[model samples]
Target: MGYNFSRFTRGIAPGSRIFAADGEPLSNDMLRAAVPSIFATEAHESRSARFAPVPTVTVLDGLRAEGFEPFSAVQARTRAEGFEPFSAVQARTRVEGKAEFTKHMVRLRHRSLTNTTGDSFEIVLVNANDGTSAYQMIPGFFRFVCENGLMTGETFSEVKVRHSGNAIGEVIEGAYRVLEDAPLVAEQVASWKAITLQDGERLALAESAHILRFPKADQDGEAPAPVQPEALLRPRRSADRATDLWTAFNVVQENTLKGGLTGRVRNAEGRLQRRTTREVAGIDQNRSLNRALWLLTQRMAELKSA
Candidate 1:
């Protein structure tokens, strides 16, 4: 029941009589007033997420054509709505200097499958620190000696570590350097193909991306690949070397002392009490021990430095 100036205007000027679809006269003033209420219902306050203000290109105008959106309508309309440019997202889509939402990291790491055997693969974020390693700047350091970096001259990379397998065998961590050669890489690629897998474990491996150059021993008829020392540069290999050195040195010292001295050698602490245990029943036990354990430990620690 809107008032019409023509009917109620007593004498307001006449133009079109605004009418409902049924042709009932509706006043022009009421139509003008209703537009505001309609717009109020529709123009909500959306959070602005761009470094630059989104162009007010009506609801239908294209961004680039209007010069308001970071990308043109053709571009933005094709991608997800939130798919802002990386730079724009970093600049404006912030929660205290960080994007509220962004791409996440996917990483490659080496895991020792067994004491003598091991494998490397990719793992999604598994630890808070791995989530923060880039900021920390320090390189990977973990127990079980994944690889000897410095000594072997191996380049380092992010490697998430965990102790599995009941850790019964030699505690070891393996480090890997990516190969640059296409064919060998292709071969290794074929090697990591899916094998039989146990429950709740991994079997397939993404191709190794680490590319390091080192010296390699001259081979026979086979085409000599990039001359880097693949085995020597491996962390496990270098750690093994340090370990072997430790063992050999201990063996020589043990044999020399065993034959040259009866039991305990006298030192500045002369004639220290040698509590000898006697197994009267010819007790026999076999033990394999590394003489260079400390040296290996030191060497391993140093290798990880690089």
Candidate 2:
């Protein structure tokens, strides 16, 4: 139940930082400091001439024009090796230069859908000027209770725009496409909230999520998972203690990604050592795991109804 909120606030990648708006639209200055990649004017130099550079800022401006206000932003850190480690200033310069071209994600809320109660849908934008990623938009849910941003299942279509011609126009269209699907996502959440899980079902859900976070080598493998499956069902806050499918999904998702549970693991010396799970800090891994968990819960709901 004791969750480390700081770890969640820290950016998804190493050396990265996250900036969230405090009841106001995030300023360009703040975003530039936290996610310089968002403002990159050109692609990485390694990119070939055929690789057209679609600056993320251009798409972001286009989204803003469509009334989508960015609330949070984060960028992955890319380090250049073989730098002069002795000079701290040079190392800092190398990191800053690479940061401008790395991958970044921004969470935006439509002005029309902004509210102060319950969960609301968000447009999650991911892109990179370095050709590591295309301009992708996914539907996200912002839970007010825990301030968690959850990526929806594959039921909500993801929009991707290549860096070629009219990329900005495509991205803006994609944002609206996600916006149009918000009602369906809301209906899904409502259904989840209405469906309550029995104790066994909750445990089953936890077990499945555990396997996802810590897969076994084989049935005969001696090494056990660092944490028990049941542990993930423990809610960080009292409000999330319900047995409803939505609550169960959020609890498991948070526990799996923001791992801090203690358990025992066999070390290289063949002795049991106390170990704690680390958070899923990679941008792509976070998105994939979140989507997988959502799909798992959706399947469970279908089975329960059948």
What clash count goes with each model?
17, 1
Worst 10 residues of 1 by lDDT: 279-288
Most TM-score-accurate candidate: 2
Which stretches of model 1 miss by more than 4 angstroms?
1-100, 103-141, 144-306
Residue 66 local lDDT, model 1: 26
RMSD of candidate 2 to true structure, Å: 4.9
lDDT scores of the candidates, listed in order: 0.19, 0.75
Candidate number with greatest lDDT: 2
Residue-by-residue lDDT tens digits, candidate 1, 1-306: 001100111111122112233312223243333211111111112323222211122211221132211100000001224444322211121222212121111111222211232221221111111111111010211112221101101132323333223221111122122212223422322332322222111100000100111012133433222222121212222333322322222222222111111233233345543322111110000000111222233343344333
Q: Could you tell me the lDDT of residue 200 within candidate 1?
A: 16
Candidate 2 Cα lDDT to native: 0.75
In candidate 1 the C-alpha lDDT for residue 221 amounts to 34
Off by over 4 Å in 2: 1-15, 80-97, 216-223, 268-271
- What is the TM-score of candidate 2? 0.87
- TM-score (all chains, Cα) for each model: 0.14, 0.87
lDDT of 2 by residue, 15-124 (tens): 35554646587767777777777888887887788777778788778778878888777665454564333222111223346667887778888888866657778888
